[model samples]
Target: MTTSTPAPTEAGLDLVTRLNAYLEDVAATLGIRGESCSVDLTGPVAARMRLNWRLPGFPERDVDLMWHEEHGWSAAVATHSGDGHHVVVAYLGGRTVASQPRLVARFADSLRAGEHQDCWPGPPMLRTAGGPSALAKELAAWA
Candidate 1:
């Protein structure tokens, strides 16, 4: 017998849609062309985006951004080991998990300008109490 994966619930689909739109807004705020960025929402409560943005000294490395229901947004770089791993480099450090797109854009700009703070070698601990449902509700206000 074969078992198939469960389909996403309507709530989960709505959350993904909102998250995708938010990432698009962030790209617009940063003046990044659509082709230079990509967002992934395959997971139930997490999302990831990749920007064709390179730091001044590391022109070959692309910037990776991720958001979780609990941890919000964090920036990272793909590890050099070719093992499909990323190293967390900076956290948005905001009070809420779902911050305004403009604020997230500012965080990206800071990273580009080499002035970012809140650097950590690993992903930070949970920063928000609300889970996916709460995040979906918060994003609903953005509509």
Candidate 2:
């Protein structure tokens, strides 16, 4: 029997490129090095960014920001575990997909001050179920 692999969809590629650019914007807004930002285009499409400064109360732990297609943006502390797990501290709960870089920087600033009031206890509820292509369309207007 012969098997063939399917090519990556154009929408998926577009989403990846756009998401990478978004992460770069976020890093620039926060004054973080570009190398500290990364995006995972597989599955649900997610991005992770590491801040140079630590969280206010937890001086030893590093702060990280994450974004998911279904959950928007979140802040967490990178745990000591080498398995890449994090302790979620807050969720930036307005839009379920994307938030502007300035808004993200503002959120991070609030987190550093230990006075962030806009945090949601859990990840934001899903707003769209159309998956990658849908997310790409939504991110199209991101600037």
Candidate 3:
């Protein structure tokens, strides 16, 4: 038997849609060809979602993106091997370069080129945080 996940709220859906569109544009700008790429709404109240993309001759990749009205945005890329992960988070004073399409494009380019050294190409402010649950809680309250 399978359990169904509830649909996200309209507000949640809208934010995810916007983020997805930004990434899609970034991919296009970088000339990263993919037969199909899409975003999944993972946690609406948490303002969480994920993007999956697969370029020709390569395995797919997943990137978790989240947002908080006060904190801005954050991104997490989980290694396919399930052994490691990378995170890009908001900076001091609640500033974030993570939402910039060009930066995300560079990250995708680095991954595609196999030049990702210990999650290089990340923002200078990048660091590991307590994880999504905290952000999710914060977003839930705001929602």
Candidate 4:
């Protein structure tokens, strides 16, 4: 049987919705112009059988996105189980420059605490959405 989450009534969402709302606040900054609270609604599942199916893959749960006007998608914090699977959140303009380690550090707890942060196209790849998924050398695996 499929896992059941609370269905949102015409008036409001279930617990997950409320939590995402809270996470969004912690992840985003004032300088950023956009604030989006979204979910990768696949499952509250698992992600590693080491490459096997038996290894319950991580579920696709809710992730918070906090965009900085000066930066891009600076943070992406999750509320439940499958939390730190993502690396970069949202990409900005068309020039991925100035994404400092300090900035990414600020977004840490917000974007899955204990996860590593890496910007796609850290230099010239700044302004594009999903600037590039090419893993960074220094990355400890995009948490």
Candidate 4: residue 98 lDDT (0-100): 29
Any runs in candidate 2 off by more than 4 Å, and if so which? 1-7
Name the 10 consecutive residues with the lowest summed lDDT in model 3.
Answer: 89-98
Superposed by TM-score, candidate 1 places the C-alpha of residue 143 at a distance from the truth, in angstroms, of 2.8
For this target, which candidate reaches the highest lDDT against the unseen true structure?
2
Give the residue spans of candidate 1 off by over 4 A: 1-6, 33-44, 118-132
Question: Residue 21 CA error for candidate 3 (Å)?
Answer: 1.7
Please provide, for model 4 over 41-94, each residue's C-alpha lDDT reduced to its tens digit, 9 standing for 90 to 100. Answer: 233211110101111122343333333322434433244555445443433233
Model 1 clashing residue pairs (backbone):
none
Better of 3 and 4 by lDDT: 3
Q: Candidate 3: what lDDT?
A: 0.42
> Please, what is the whole-model Cα lDDT of each candidate in the order they appear?
0.66, 0.76, 0.42, 0.31
Best by TM-score: 2
How high is each candidate's TM-score?
A: 0.74, 0.87, 0.38, 0.24
Error of 4 at 40 (Å): 2.7
Candidate 1 residue-wise lDDT, 1-143, digit = tens: 01122366877567656666666776677676545444444443565567767766667666677776667788878777777577777888666667788888878788889987544445555555454456667677554
- Per-residue C-alpha lDDT of model 3 across residues 71-133, encoded as one tens digit per residue: 444455556687645454222213342345566555555554655453423334332333334
Count clashes in each candidate, considering only residues at least 3 apart in sequence or on different chains. Answer: 0, 0, 0, 18
TM-score of 3: 0.38
